[model samples]
Target: MPELPEVETVRRDLHRLLRGQWVKNVSVNKEKMVRGSTSLFKRNLRGLLVQGVKRRGKLLIFSMTDDKSLLVHMKMTGQMIYQSKQTLVGGGHGQPRVKRDELPNKYTHVVIVFGDGARLFFNDMRQFGYMRLVNAKQLEQVVKRFGVEPLSKAFTPDKLRRLVRGRKTSLKNVLLDQRGVAGLGNIYVDELCFLAGVRPMRRADKVTDREIVKLHKAAINVLKRAIAARGTTFNSYRDGLGGEGKFVRMLKVYGRSGKLCVRCKTILKRVKIGGRGTVYCPVCQK
Candidate 1:
């Protein structure tokens, strides 16, 4: 799954390359994954001019000229590749590396052609992603479901405390809950836990005030650094410019299960919490 860093990188790149470009045509090969009526989706998209691109949680919001926005969720295995006459860029999570010759091969399900001759391709090997068009009013209603934007200034210590109050779920689970903290996923959650010296298995209600402050700072720092580096790319994930991220080299304990911890020399441990694989240093993290 492409988490906050990967999604934000895509949003930034797409905004730079796609703003003000008119959608000339729409083609959908896998109809089942599209959310709204196909005809309505195509009609709203065909001639609309893109005003801007923004992201909330993991969703991409493409603001259009007619007050309608295009919402795309690149679920697991989905990739959005953009190509113009002068440049080509994009990559996503879950699919194998996209070969230069193999693009638009079989996984390319949706293609949006622009008036400038540039094309945006939405590819998903698993067919679970979806694209939908919504009016501005409906878009507001949709965004209301998302919780606090973790990167925003509004996410203060009080905000963090309020969300964690009386919650029995593990701290990692609380972070993963979109209704509590939008844009956090398993990968960054693990990194945040390790950075804060908090155990992923620690219950939210049991977190101390000192630990809460550390957790909040850790999340913000990790996200900001990851965004700066573009994003973590293991196999399939890529930035909107089709480049890989440099954050994987900075990772501490996300995937190094048996590796020695950089802090305490203890073998990092792997545990499954909420069905997600979690890694941490036994000595460094509580």
Candidate 2:
């Protein structure tokens, strides 16, 4: 699944290309890829102007001129490709570099036509992604579900401390909960813990005040770096331009379980916390 950075990358790229374009038509090859009534979904999107694109958590919100929005979640193995005469940008999970001609292939599920004849294709190999049309009032209710975005200014050391002050869960599990701090996934969580020198298995309540500050700083730093690198691409994570991100090569512990730790030269160990695979350097993180 595309986390915050990857999803934000797609949101920004889509905003650059699709914003201000009027919807010419809508087509759904697989109706299950859409949520709510299919007829209403098509009806709300056609002729609506795309004002902008926003992202909440891992979902993409398409603000429209008609007081409605298209909420899209690329669950897994999903790809969103925008095509035009001279430019092409595809974002989501699947393929490091997607070709323009290869689009609308077997995975193509939903296609949105623009006034300029450009089309945006939604492809999901696993068929788990879905798009829902929501009204202005409904959009408000949806946005409230997400917690504080770590990349936003609302997230700070004090705020981070307050969120997990009394939590008895492991640090990894606490960080994974979107209700407290949004946008953290397994990949970046491991990196953040490594950067802050905090063990993933430690309880949130047991983390020292200094460690909290470090974790706060580390979270922002890791996320900013990942976004700058266009997000980590391991199996299929891609940017809006169908370009693979460069952060995977910079990962320290996420997938380096049996590898040597960069800081202490000790072999990284992999363990399971909160049922998710976690990697850490035993000698470096305590």
After superposition, the stretches of candidate 1 with alpha carbons farther than 4 Å from their true spots are: none
Could you estimate the TM-score for every candidate? Answer: 0.97, 0.96
Q: Stretches of candidate 2 above 4 Å error?
A: 95-97, 235-237
lDDT of 2 by residue, 1-286 (tens): 7888888888899999988999999999898999888888898799999999988878899999878989998887788899998888888886434677876888898999999999999998898889999998998898888889998889989988887789898989888888788778889999999999999999989999899999999999999999998888877555777678988899999999999999989999999998899999998899
Cα lDDT, model 2, residue 106: 82
Global lDDT of model 2: 0.88
The global C-alpha lDDT for each of the candidates, from Candidate 1 onward, is 0.88, 0.88
The residue-by-residue lDDT of candidate 1 on 86-177, one tens digit each, is 77788567356665656575888888999998989888888888888999899999999999999999898789889989999898889999
Residue 165 displacement (Å), model 1: 0.8
In Å, residue 123's CA in model 1 sits off its true spot by 0.6
Q: Residue 184, candidate 1: how far off, in angstroms?
A: 0.8
